[model samples]
Target: MRLYVTPASPWVRRVRVCIDELGIGDRFEYVQTRWPHAWGTRTVEMPADFVEATPVVRIPALVADDVTLTDSHSIIDYLDGKFGNHRLLAADGPGRWKAQETNALACAILEAQIMRRAELLRIGADRSDDFIAKMRDRGLRCFAALEKQVPSFGDAFDLAQITTAVACGYDDWRYGPAWREAAPTLTGWYDTVAQRPTMKATEPAETPER
Candidate 1:
């Protein structure tokens, strides 16, 4: 199996950490990609061959079981089903929905963060204050909501918890500590999660390779 990642993306980090927790790291060939940019430069460029392989040309793609898997959640589903850690998600029911909701919330943080990043990338004259503010507000709401929900996460370390932690880490790395003041509960959660070896190993650089 091959795991292609954009080192700076929390989406990719989610997959990487999942692979680690599943104990399947040995089966995956790690491939680093500089998507939406070329090696620390502002130029947007997906790897030529990767673009040819998938319509979306997104990173954190997995080539396994003789098929290509796109999207972070899809990969999570695959691993949870096969690996059956029993920690990634609930076995079924409203419990599953609760986990899914948390996962979606965490993913939403990244979505807003990515949007803000793209907006920032626009040439100064083209950037819109309204759009940037919208993204920032959206992210802020996500952080606040997740912070309130963190206590319910309890003692078990599951997929939702993992993703929530990744969301905070990504924000800290990409945006800044401004969120810390808003999401204090999540701030405490991240302090512990960041110490996990998987997280330490996959931590995003403050600046991407570009």
Candidate 2:
């Protein structure tokens, strides 16, 4: 199995952390996708060889078990099913529904973080303060809710926690780490979560994995 990823992507990092925590890293060959540093102003294209397998040209695509999984949620869910000794998603009932609900909220927060990141990457006049402000406001709203809910974060460290952690990590990486000040409780929770071996091992870097 080959997992295509980039070092700086939280989506890829979340999946990597999941596989590492589940003891399934040996089942995958981590393929670091590269784009031309000289693409200049044009949108980047998938490196030629990887284009066919990844329709969206995104990271965290997994080629495994005779199927190609192209999204982070799909990849992580598949890994959990195959190798999870302890389940990330609940078996059924309220716990399952709650996890799904929390995950959806976390994912929306993650999207806001990414949206802000896109705004930041634009150069000078190309950047849009309106978009950045909107995304920043949206993400902080989500963080505010999560901060109130932090006391309920158990020690289990399941999918909801995984997504929440990565969203916080990404916020710190690209958004001036202001969320730490804005959401003190969630920040405290993340400081503890960041110490986990899987989290420490997958902290984002510019260097590509071989």
Q: Give lDDT per model, in order.
A: 0.79, 0.80
Error at 17, model 2, angstroms: 0.8
| Candidate 2 global TM-score | 0.90
Alpha-carbon RMSD, each predicted model: 2.6, 2.5
Which residue pairs clash in candidate 2?
none
lDDT of 1: 0.79
**Per-prediction TM-score to the true structure, in the order listed:** 0.89, 0.90
lDDT per residue (tens digit) for residues 42-79 in model 1: 54566676665555766678788766888888888887
State the local distance difference test value for candidate 2: 0.80
lDDT of 1 at 119: 79
State, as a TM-score between 0 and 1, how close model 1 is to the true structure.
0.89
lDDT of 2 by residue, 1-210 (tens): 999888778889889988887877887888878754322245676666577667777777888767898889888877887778438887678887877877777888878876776667678797789998999999888887778767777779998899889888888776667788778989988999999999999988663423
